[model samples]
Target chain A: MKLLKLIFKNSLRHKLRSSLTIIGIAIAIIAFGLLRTVVTVWNSGVDAASANRLITRQAVSFIFPLPASYRAKIASVPGVKEIGAANWFGGVYKDKSNFFAHMAVDDNYFVVYPEFIVPKDEMEEYKKNRNACIIGSQTAKQYNIKLGDQVVLEGDIYPGRWEFNVKGIYTPRDQNTDATQMLFHYEYLNETMLQQSPGRANSVGWYIVQIEDPNNSASVSKQIDALFMNSTAETKTETEKAFTQGFISASGAIITSMNFMSFAIIGIIMLVLANTMIMAARERTREYAVFKTLGFSAKHLTGLILGESLLISFLGGGVGLFLLYPLIEGFERAMPKGFFPYFYVEPITIILAVTATLLVGVLSSVFPIHRALNTKIVDGFRHVG
Target chain B: MADIIQVNNLSKSYWRNSLEIPVLSELSLNVNEGEFLALMGPSGSGKTTLLNIIAGIDRPTNGSVSVSGTDISKLNESALAKWRSSNVGFVFQFYNLIPVLTAFENVELPLLLTKLNKSERKKHVETALNIVGLGDRIYHYPKQLSGGQEQRVAIARAIVTDPLLLVADEPTGDLDKNSADEILTLMERLNKEFNKTIVMVTHDPHAASRASSLLHLDKGVLSTNGQSH
Candidate 1:
């Protein structure tokens, strides 16, 4: 039999031990993979953010409003290509449980986010009616919404029942695109505010600014914020990536714990596999002595020990990865819609997982290899049994 | 017969907390080609230590051992290992067969070092096992075999490479009388018919009587009074 065959047979020598170690490693890998996927989904927005797009929000916080008149000032900025006024509507559809991002946006908002694919006819229908709204494909699917259908919202922030027609449905341009937001006319909300809370009228939450060149975004953002410097509504401007990153920080602890736990799982994997290997090596001391007597080199013993470790590691890792895809799918389905807009197993996660498993395999074999190579044949024979 | 194995002023010692504990001291010895020589001694007599030195599995603190022509004591660890694979066969006291490997696989271990094809190695393994009267039990694991059968499989492994010398340390020490006689008879036939040289260390006089020549070790040195050739 080949040396590989011997390695394979030796790994199976203690059937229960090998199997248990393999299962433990597999489960740890799955947990690590799941945590990694959560972390990836957590940053999906930042990954999809456009470099040329920038957000100008009140320096105090995103919750505060900017005067609607600032949209014209932002549009006049030297490098600004397109600018739109928008506000966080926070309008609940039916009950508080039916949660989704509802935002009020002017016509140019859609232009700034071209990744939202809206049809020509639907765009015309949406522009024709001030009460018309565009819901993302996922949002449409969740509410079973259709074009020309009236969608009513109980305004939690504005304290009024509002009605709007679904004039268009927009789909995501790519996997990282979030298709879970509902966009309606900012003017419609502004008009209701003017008639009701006059003080909150003619104000937008933020300005969505697109620039001529992404390289000029930093200068343009500085120029936009400088326009309102020392004013009651001082603005903080940054690229969409930074905006999304700031948004992710809202749930920072969860992601931080997941990052910690992912690495913690790797440590655990190394310890479990090392324990199994050390025990096996101890039990096979005399056998290694016999091998030396038969003229097997230290390199051969290393191959046997390292090969068995890698075999078990890869077996566990392979099974864990195979189980991860379905587990993530189930996890995604079990969560409320739009909870994590783009849940995907990124390629880097697989690369890191495979790399970690191989590293752990090599690491676990260190002590065993040293023991095998250092033990004199005579002393090993003395330790028989 | 030419002296196929030679030893000159060999010494082996272990260091315990800066104290010297000698196992073999200034020992000199020789064995002719095709000779089945047995070494008999009491516990702590250093017979096994001497056997290990001759087998290239351990090193001496002083002096040299030459088998056939090469001074094995002068070879580096890796080179000595390679030389042993090509020139020396070993049978251990406990019949140290790999418990995970089948008899066929165990016999194939030494041959794995050779540049032989799978079929060629298989043929050599079968021939060796047949010579040891274990041809039909090639697929059995070491744990599946009785004490005598395991020793036979280890012997099969030892001879499969057709090495120049065989060194067995208490090869039949763990076997019953009938099994011990069978193993000794097999070793004798290998020496007499095939001319395979052997140096065995044993405690039992019955086992030593089966050897064509005999020696005794006392106080870490060879005893000339019990020496016979």
Candidate 2:
């Protein structure tokens, strides 16, 4: 107990240096936490993807479209239980900067994605009218859009000024479910495109196929892709997770760099802590020599040094995490809505943050412990530091 | 009385880029229990080095030092540390108290190696502090105490474990004359009343005068100016 008191006192002996080091460690941990959260959010769609769902898109690229006729053919596959189609209606709502995912979906779309829980009456109302649409709760809250409100969008890809009536607002079934998109009927879009541009009529960006058994997804994907083999819009079918992952992997370098940077923060924290521990050990060389003469064993000396280091690290980590929760909340609020949908710290991020600090604590103490333990009694006394 | 310390043919040296710099030559000494012996020498006379060897804080290049019939020089690092903890205590010139600890905590340091509980350790610490005339100042940090008071706290720390011998290297080297006199008087009482075996190294003849016997060293060897009172 007395020894522990000494360790605590020794760590705070230089208040300014210790405080600065702790602050440095804390800031580094915060940076690490934020970056890891971002990486988690980037891959969140893939993690939330349904295992029983398969996506069939143009093999050449997602930008290319597949015939809407492919849907009936895909639904006939033995394992296919249901099928839905969506066309990416890239459009500007109010302003280009006020961005959100907008898609035109077939009537059976909600049946495949059960995580989007829309009111049955609202969904029926949306399906009854040709110009009715459903916006997610996040989008409704972001834009103040309500039922029976009018939503006007200038289409960039389809190239037209379009308008629709908001018929319903869909909320997420769970936290991981995306509530940042707007969904409308593909029939309205197809009827317009059929007259405006015959080449783009009755086509969809992707087809979502629901299978009877999730385990058969590989075979089901192969069979769907084989049906469209050597055709103009060759289909590449895969599990919903892989399809979502394919989009995430398009920014693979950025996520990879972010992953690298998060660990780099851990490395920076280690360096800061190691520097502090080393300086503290150096300053106490004579004191350690006195301890040696007082008959302190190597174990005792090690305890003193390591105890002080770990105490400092744990303190920093605690403060960092304490500040992180509110900081993440404010960060999410400050970000443009739907910019990073579901931007919350994952449990794995917290675990890694804690484990990183612990590792830094032990690693930072290594050189200092070795130095203190190896110093001869006479030499330690002679050390000016 | 039994000889509490035995030093036989002790030597110490170090190397400076392969050039051996000898600090002490083969020397022999012995002191009985309860004897207060002062080692006085000029600068570079190796009095401190000799004191360090007898205290078992430093190893001799050759020969052995035995305390209570145990050859301390033969012990390994940890064994030597264990032997020193129970057998030897050291008082430094600078009072080397851990500045972060209170006077009471500083004195309790050596006894931490013992199996004494907190209250037992506290009791022992208070007694040692009272013996050094600092009982009322146990809660004071080294920075809050006078130079003489700090040295007293150091003496308390040294004796707290009740070691077999108390070795001091220039104990009054950093004190004013009045503080030095008080320290010498306390040592006198500890030797006369407590029957402690003490070996002190100093350059001051005045400090050496308080010892029952005196020896002078020159060039790492004891000179013939040694005498007993």
Candidate 3:
């Protein structure tokens, strides 16, 4: 206990150096947490996907559409229960500044994926009205989309502006399923696009499939793709998770680079801590010698130095985590729509940061402790001051 | 006189790559309990080496050193350190008190190695500080005190554990004449009143004069000065 007290006191010998080292550790940990959260949020779509669901999109490009009649064939496939067709309808609200993920989904969207729950009365009203729309709770809050408000969407592909009455607001049943999308009637886009290309009006961006048995999803997906092998829009069927993962796969190299960069950040933290610990240890050479001359063993001296390093680094890590939570939360609230859905430091990230700080503490103390222990008693005496 | 520290065939050497330089060659000595002895020699006479060996801070190349019937030479590095913490207290020439510690904290350092409780350790430190007449200055840091007061605190620290052997290596080397005299008087009183077994190394004849006995060394061999009170 006394040894610990001495170690604590000695660590505070150079307040500026100690504080700076801690701040450095804190900054490193905060950066590590943010990077890990970025990776997590990036993969969140895949992580939160339901196992029983499958998506069939254009084989070569999602920009191409599948014939809308294929949805009826998919719904009749053995073990298949329900199906809905939806298209990515890129739109801006008010102006380009207010952007969000706007999709034209079928009225059967509720039956295709039951995870997206809407109030019974709202769903009935939405089904009764052709121009009714559904917005995610988060999106509704962001744009103040009340149940009666008319939302005007500026379209990029349909060649005409569209308007819909907000009929319902939905919240996610799970964390991975983001409640930030704007879903409306697929007939509205089909009708508008038919005016431009009358033959393509009977097409959709993708088919969402729900099966009776989740374990047979892979077999069913293979069967579905085989059925479309000779069709004009050759379909690629995949689990919802794989489909979401495909979206992120486009930026795989960038995410990999970020992973490498985070490791580099840890390495830099180690170096800075090592430098500070070495400096502190060197400055206390005479003091350590005195300790040795007073009959302190090599192990005792080692403990003293390492204890100081661990204490400083751990304290810094704690401070870094403290700053991270509020900063990320504030940014989460102010985040532009569809940029980062869920930004947070997970439990795993916290554990990783703490473990990294401990490793840095031990590594940083190694050289200084070695230098201190190797000093001869007589040499220590000679340098007395 | 019963010998408290016994050395036999003691020798120490330094190696510079291929060359072996002997500091002390096949020398031996014995000191009885409660004896105040001064070791004096010219530069390079190996007085400091001899003191270091007896204090267990350095190992003899070839020899055995037994203090209070324990063969310190047979103990490993860690065991020897533990033994020395309980057996020896050192007062260095420059008043080598740790600058960051207060007088009381300095005195409490060696006591940390003991199993004594905190209150008991405090009592021992207070008694030791009072012995050096610096009890009131226990809270003063080493830098705040004068040279004499600092040395007195060093003395207090050395004797705080009441070690059987108190080793002084030129304890008054850095002081003025009056301060040196005061330190010498304090040493005399410690010898007469506390009956501490003191072995001091000094080049100052005036300091040596206060010792009950003096041993002179030249060329690493001890020769009795035959001067005693």
Candidate 4:
């Protein structure tokens, strides 16, 4: 305990240097935490996917639509319970920068996804009107939309200005599930498309199938795909989680880059910490010699050096984590609805940051402590400083 | 009196780029218990080397150094360090007190190795500092103290563990004339009143005069024929 006190005091010998090093370490930790959070948020889509749900889309590409007739065939598959379909509207509000997810979903979409909670009256109101729609709570908040407001969507794909009444605002039952999407009846889009372009009618972007047993998802998915074998629009059926994972893998390079960036920040912090420790050890050569002359063992001196290094690292890590908590809260609040809605720093991420900081502290001190202990007492005494 | 330090044909050498530079030859000496022995020599005459060898801080290239009946020359580096901690004290020329620590804390350093608790360590440190007339300045840092006061704090630190021998390498070399005299006087008092065996290396004649006997080293040869004043 006495040795620890001495080590603490010694670390403060060069006040400016220690403070600067700690600040540098804290900044690196902040960068590391932010990057890890980005990777976590990106993978959250897959993490929050329901086990009992399967998504069927065009085998060629998601951009190509599947004939809505495939929905009945998917529901007839042995393990399937219920089915719903949606079509991507690709609409922008006011400008492209004010973009949010807009989709045309089947009237029975809530039956397949029971987690999107809407008030009973609002759900009834939505079913009563053809041009009525439900927006996520996050989307509603973003545009200051209320239960009786009119929302105008300038369609990018259907290429028409569509107007709808905001009938309700839905929230997610699970916090990890996104609540930033705008959902409307697919029949309205189908009828409008039939009048504007006849060929695009009776088509959907994907089919969501809720299965009776999650364990039979694989076989059921295979059975559903076989129904559309060699058709004009072949279908690919997979669990909802796998579908989300497929989207993640489609942008594999970006996620991989984020992972690399997280590790790179740790490396940079290690270098900075190592440099600081080495310089401190170099300046205390004579002091170490004094300790040796007073009968301090080489091991004791090494412990002192390591203790000082660990102290600096732990302090920096704590401060960095403290700063990160509020930053993550602010970031989540500022993010657009439906875009990375569940972005948060997980407990595992905090554990990893602490572990990395400790490893950096121990590893960085090894070389300097070894060098300090190896200096002969006689020679160390000769060093005036 | 029984001998506290017995040196038999001690030698020390350094290698500079594969060229051997001999610091001390096979010089032999003995210091009795409760005696003040001063080593006087010119620069590069190996006075400090011999002093270090006697204090068990350095191993001799040849010959054995027995302090308090233990052959320190044959001991391993770790064992020598332990032996030095409990049996020897060091006072360097520039005081060598940790600048960040108070005088009391500096004196308490050697006692940290012992199993004594904090209060016990504080008691021992206070007694040692009071003996050196720095009890009132226990909380003062090294930079806050004058040269003489710093050297007194160093003395307190050296004796806090109550070692068998106190080894000083020019303890007053960095002090002014009055401060040097005061440090020499303190050493004299420690030797006479506390019966502490002391081995000091210095070039100052006045510093050497305070010892019971004087030994001169010239080119690694020791001549104990110089009479003490």
Interface RMSD values for all candidates: 0.8, 1.0, 1.4, 0.8
lDDT of 4 by residue, B94-193 (tens): 8889998999999999999999999999899999999999989999999999999999999999999999999999999999999999999999999999
Candidates in order, TM-scores: namely 0.95, 0.93, 0.93, 0.92
The value of fnat for model 2 is: 0.74
True contacts kept of each: 0.81, 0.74, 0.40, 0.84
Per residue, candidate 4 scores C-alpha lDDT tens digits across A1-385 of 7788888897888889889888888888888888889898898888888999999999999899999887777878898999999999998887776767899999778888888999999999999999999998877887799999999999889898999999999998887777888899999999998999999999999999999999999999999999989999998999999899988897789989988998898898898989999988888889898988887888898899999999999888888898988888787767664467667788878999999999989998999889888999888878765
Selected candidate, larger lDDT, 2 vs 3: 2
Cα RMSD (Å) between model 2 and the true structure?
Answer: 2.6
Better of 1 and 4 by lDDT: 1
Q: What lDDT does model 3 reach?
A: 0.86
Candidate 4: regions farther than 4 A off: A114-132, A144-152, A159-168, A194-198, A211-219, A329-338, B17-19, B226-229
TM-score comparison, 1 vs 3, better candidate: 1
Query: Which whole-number lDDT from 0 to 100 does residue A67 have in model 3?
Result: 92
lDDT of 1 by residue, A141-212 (tens): 877998888999988788888999999999999988999888999889999999999999999999889899
Model 2: CA > 4 A from native:
A119-132, A144-154, A158-169, A191-200, A212-218, B223-229
lDDT of 1: 0.91
- Cα DockQ of the candidate 3 complex: 0.61
How are the candidates ranked when ordered by lDDT, highest leading?
Answer: 1, 2, 4, 3
Give every collision pair in model 2: none
Screening candidate 4 with a backbone cut-off below 3 angstroms (N, C-alpha, C), the clashing residue pairs are none
Candidate 2 lDDT, A50-128, residue by residue in tens: 9999999999998999998998899999999999999999899988778789999998899999889999899889989
Cα lDDT of model 3 by residue, A228-344, tens digit: 898788999999999998899989998888888777888999999899888887777777866876788898898898999899989988998899898777767676655775566
